[model samples]
Target: MAERLLIGALKSGKNTKIVTLNGKKMTKMPSTLGKLPRLKTLDLQNNLIPKVCPEISALTQLTVLNLGNNLLEEVPEEMKYLTSLKTLHLFGNRICRIAPGACDGLQNLILLNLNNNQLTELPQEVNRLKSLTCLNINYNQLTSIPRELCFLEDLSELHLNYNQLICIPEEIKFLKKLQKLFLVRNNIEVLPEGICDLKKLRILDIAGNIIQIFPPRFQDLKLREFYCEENPLILMQPFAAKHQENIWSLKEITSRFVLNQLAEENPFLMNAIEHYPEVRSIISGGKNCAICGKFFLTVWLECVQFVPPSKNWKISKNLQLVPLRILLCSYKCFNQRDPNLFGISQE
Candidate 1:
């Protein structure tokens, strides 16, 4: 059998640096492979290996291990001894769990692929790989991303598509060096405004979701490839209609039409524009807080109706319809105002 020949060859070459037995239909790894203590690359992809043998730890010099397209159910904990490992490919497997300490000592790892598996959650220990730069966990059942993943400050590329994620955490902004991010085909309803802070992001895929709007600062990003198709993007309707093309520019997305569309969709914004035209004029003229007359990067609209005229007083019906609008830079400013006469809560 091919396994017998592979074991014979490994036993004969004790200093073998590379051993490839890809698509050999291997069910189990022979313990004789441990004799090659100098093995640096081992390729056993496209096999039936149910589990990795602990004896693999004897190959302490292993740097690249490929076990893709197999039936592996869990990562062997003994792999922690392979401190020299840099790239591990476990894609196309039935792996549902990873034993504790499986990645505890893998400090030298730079790329890891666990895609197309049944993993529901990632182990917290994966955060220990400070040297990791690329990671692929696409096509899994993950409902949420671990906040601990933010510790990978050196990471540049992260693929988390085809999962069941409902939201992307604000902590993702910590990946300052990230250049590519793929979140296609998820249940994501909203993207945190913090995503606009990823200055190095060039490719952003957010297709196939129910996202209605993007942060006002999103136009500041200098992305090269932006895939937002297939999403129910209601706020970007004006931009989408005008551009008909796949590519988008920052100017087109941040145009007055798009901004006006976003404001029209919000009840509080519409009320402020309709009832108090001065607030709209002030915002359109410049970026200063209408209430305190201070420069601000963020602001909210709060509207309050005037106290109703006394029954004895005579006033036109049209004059009583106007409401006072207050542009606040923060919630504290809005809280300082007296309650509305109509008891309508500030949004």
Candidate 2:
């Protein structure tokens, strides 16, 4: 029936630039499609097309192709020859794999949607889409993102939600032009620190993960909206509690403890301890000394003693002394202390 309709359309004019056979119950694309040399847009969505017809590649002038909601097992490599193609939609398909060179000559492509597919990984040739501005691969079985994806310098929005990703690659910082990033509902345990370098980023959604800490400089970013709900995040609790919203601005995080706690838990700081032993020593020793009121970098001692009763105090049957502890930085400071003056005797 689809072939008959196309034959009728071709009989009217051989210079047809658009063909719409959507929902025509097409089990296979008719070879007669190759006869339209001036065709520019082809819509075969909601059809039963099991595979792409190799003859379709003869339509070099085709710019928009929609084969969504089909039974295609893979993307045809010959389709890459459609150099004038600008938009390709393969969503809602049974596609399990994309051949490596399947997108080699698609230099003019701008948008590619592969959402709701059975794909586990993207082809390396995807990086060759230098003109691509938006990519949607959500609701797939992707375990990881390819590093080559960061090479899409013009990409502004990326959707990877509802996947099995364990961690975001640090190379994501390379997406300098990225404005929005969607990574919700993954098994990600930690957010990569390099994400803080996205100067143009405005929205970041990492909800439903096991994130415990943010990047040390996360508060310094110019993000307009942030979402981290349903995660076991400890440092972001105060902000979330005060805002009472799933998405909030970074300016609302006014607590000093947030930065302090992040610095203590930062993996980069821990890694730096290996190269700077003195910094490790100071962090391990103590905070400050009671005698000199200076930071400690070496030995320190803590002394606990109970307060003694004074002459002005009234005698009570159930009185108890409270204990106080003092930190001494060095042995010399401890030796010079006057225990008797503090109401304690030293043997």
Candidate 3:
């Protein structure tokens, strides 16, 4: 029956650019599909196909392929030939792995769906899909994703919900065009401060995680939507009597001294940065205290300030208080902090 359908579809015309073979119980792809060289879209979803025939590679002009809800255990190696593909759906499959280089030729792929699969990790080669704008791999077994994915500068949306991820790399800040990010139901404890660098991020769903507070300047993001329910969020407490002396290690003191000199463009330190990349790296790691405006390395007092979202922002109704982190260079700086900023009780 499947063969006859393919034959009839072929007879429809040589210019047939679309074919839908959904719900077909075919165990394998009909070699007849190779005949439609000019086909731009093929829907083989809701099928029992356990594997794809090499004949699939002949459809070089294909732009969209849907192979979801199938019995496939891995991404077909033949996919590399679909160079013109813009959207590929392999969701709801048993796929646990993707053969290396299977995505090498999909340069124009804009959207990819691998949700509800068994993918434990994504291939580093996925960075090769330079044009990918949206990638969905939700409901997978991924414990971590390749930081190389952060290099996909054009990616606008990323979904990693229902995974076992403990933390995302700070490199995620490189996704400058990212708008919506969903990391629901993961094991994330603390979000990276770099996440605040994504200037275009507008919607974020981090519900069902164990996050305790937002990173500093988190409220600065012009988010239109935010979901952070079900987490053990730390609440701002009434003013408490907390006093601790600021103790700086010798390394911290020396690094701060060097950083100050570098800021003043000291000839020796400035020249060292030119010849010693490690020295440049250490200088780059310097962070300014929120209160004192002085550079500090490693040792700083952490505090939190509650910020309410602006009227235009849409956040969870239960989320009344947003904790914005603050780093102070010393106890004196902490004491001079704004009245609204509260120190986290170490009790």
Candidate 4:
């Protein structure tokens, strides 16, 4: 009956203003919207549409069109007929190209979404959307961004993460109005020198890369949040010279340690002690005998074993022990010791 009523509403020249079908399996909008000549907003979200039907371009009064979360492979060329549109959403589709004239003459377009697609490059025609402010082309197979995007002088927030970008394009430096930039998890080894030019940049994320150093004057910008984690930065001695506000990590690879030629000499010790990067302290200077408090040359880790037990005191503390120590004494000391006490003959 609702379909019949909608048919009567169209047949009687009763113009409709808005059409919303939330959570419905609308594969395509009925051709009635074009005949109304007054329909403005058409929302077709959360549907099982396999592709966008081209007949939607007849809605000349459409100001906002949402087609998110659908199986659309490409933005149809006929969509440019919606000359009065201001906001458009074609996200979560399988689109592979941002065609040259597919979105032409949309002079008032403000917000555009082409995220989560198979797009590898942005066409030069993207620069025609001069009125665009918020643009999201993230989560695609993009290796580099087309320089034409810098034309969106009004764009503020740009999301381009989860792509295979190796470095920030120099054209990106021209976005004077850009506030937030997300370029994490890329193969970048160094940041662009023109980054400080973005005076309005608040959040700059370049984590999970191999960048080991940053500009000395970067703190002059006074950014609110900076993410530079998981880089190959060593001891942050360079950052320690400033006002001490930059957050850094001291975790570096072993190769960062310097090879020092300096040494220290002592008469009591045998060799020249070399300086290591990590050695902090030493407990005892001179060694002492284990049997008595007498001074000795050295103290070593010896593997001693207990002999037979005592007669009355089965486990007396004074039980005999074999001195199976490592290299400390010469052959003369072993040859001169009494065989009865040490249990060792001349051989």
Question: For every candidate structure, what is the RMSD over all alpha carbons to the true structure, in angstroms?
Answer: 17.3, 16.9, 1.7, 23.2
- Considering TM-score, where higher is better, how would the candidates rank from best to worst? 3, 1, 2, 4
Off by over 4 Å in 4: 1-14, 215-217, 234-347
lDDT of every predicted structure (CA atoms)? 0.72, 0.73, 0.89, 0.59
Worst 10 residues of 1 by lDDT: 236-245
lDDT of 1 by residue, 192-272 (tens): 767878999888888787775565356567777676667754321111112122233454334333345534485665654
Better of 3 and 4 by lDDT: 3
Q: In terms of TM-score, how similar is model 2 to the real structure? A: 0.68
Score every model by TM-score: 0.69, 0.68, 0.94, 0.61
Given candidate 4, what's the lDDT at residue 347?
A: 24
Candidate 2 wrong stretches, greater than 4 Å: 235-347
Off by over 4 Å in 3: 239-242
Clash pairs of candidate 1? none
Worst 10 residues of 3 by lDDT: 237-246
Q: Count clashes in each candidate, considering only residues at least 3 apart in sequence or on different chains.
A: 0, 0, 0, 0
Candidate 4 is scored at a TM of: 0.61
Best candidate according to lDDT: 3
Instruction: Give the alpha carbon lDDT tens digit for every residue of 1-347 in model 4.
Output: 22343475476574677767655776655555567667788787667666655666777778888888777777777777888888888888788875557768777888888878888877888887888877877788787777788767877777777777776765676888878877766667656645657777777777666765443234444455566666553321211111112222332111112111111233323232334323222312233323332322232222122232223222213323212212212233323333322311112
